[model samples]
Target: MYDWSALPRGARASLSVAGLVMAASFLGFGALVRSLEVGLLPGLATTVFIWALPGQVVALDMLASGANLLAMALAVTLTAVRLLPMVVLVMSKVRLEGARRWPLYALSHFVAVTIWRIAEDGIDEVDRPQRLPWLTGLGLALMSSMLVMTSIGYHLAQSLPPLLAACLVFLTPSFFFISLFANAKFRMDYIAIAAGALIGPLCHQYYPEFDLLAGGLIGCTIAYLIGRAGRKRSK
Candidate 1:
């Protein structure tokens, strides 16, 4: 049995605006799954296993379109590749000097965009020894909330209006942009964000198959080069 009083600081911190936003986002995902006619169990299973929203969405869409297993797997894998850098960043933040490797491996499963954002913003406040626990707690709380909200959304999808459901689906990316703007400390960060915003839609229009990967890579590369030159000029 879990001890409620002994919840980690990270978990406690997550029970705030961040947690609420994540729940709201997953509620839309659940509705999307239902609207696609996927069973609730499979939708919930994606939450448990795939965890990443983009990957789950891709898998659901492919399944709805009757894509073969190999194609669906390839597409989901490609979408999930974006999470690798996030996992590396989060691992660097929370890993202790001599911590066990197994736990870090386990924790990597929870390093989605929302959890990554939470850790990036606040994990430093936790003691080094407790950082892992804090992250674990935060992950669990967010995951639990996602599961519950998803179940609720799935059941309520039939009654939800089209506009409202679409708005709900937009909440996560909207929060992502808001948080990026809010927490940006470097010019490069702003540049990357702006570049991505401008380039993403254009890429989607012309090269829909590779829009996300192409836009992000090009935008960040441009930002890095500009930022580097600026630093050199200042020196």
Candidate 2:
């Protein structure tokens, strides 16, 4: 194993907390949905592979309704498009140092909001060589938690209160926004997230499958334009 001891003390701690938070918010909901039998093994498999919550929701929901497998795949793929840029940006940061490339590819599969938060905080101080091991630890820890919690939720779905479960479903986004509010460095990200949040849902009411993927594009465009105008005016 790589030297994970190199992770900054604060970063390692922060990553652990973020992973637990994600578990509290999301794992139960996934289990509940699974228990309902609306989405079964195939859908859960997608959760492992696809990783994006929105796309998983769409896939399971559509698949449950007997939607064509090809359509389900396309929709999930579209929703996941956001990760391409995000992954690239993160990789660009650590790639120049050049650690083992294989684990980076393996770790990429587990990269999601929880791990992302921890990685962002933990890797800042670590040397380039150690960035990935720290990330691997973070990813592995969170993925294990998710798998465990989902199984628990699946079995206990009947006992868990529906109202509380609903709240749990929103936890991911809530933590996400809280992270955004705390950590947003760029004006564009702030604007883009807010616009995307508002427009993404509203657009969903009209176009459920495409709302997030497409609204994100539109919201990003508008936010970028606004940011550009603001920058020019400030200068």
The residue-by-residue lDDT of candidate 1 on 1-235, one tens digit each, is: 2122434666677777778777787887888788789788888888999998878887777777777787677768866886898899998887776556887888899998877887788777766677777788888777887899899888777777878777766665576668678758778888989888888788988966555566777888999899888888888
How far residue 166's Cα lies from its native spot in candidate 2, in Å, is: 3.0
Residues 1-235, candidate 2: write the lDDT tens digits.
Answer: 4465744432445345566676665565565466447744654575577776666667776766677777677767876775776677567655644356777688788666655655566567877766766666666566655666666655555566877666655554565568667757679879988898899889988987666566778888999999999889899
Candidate-wise lDDT, in order: 0.78, 0.66
Query: Considering summed lDDT, which 10 consecutive residues are worst modelled in model 1?
Result: 1-10
Clashing pairs in 2: none
For candidate 1, the lDDT comes to 0.78
Residue 17's lDDT within candidate 2 is 59
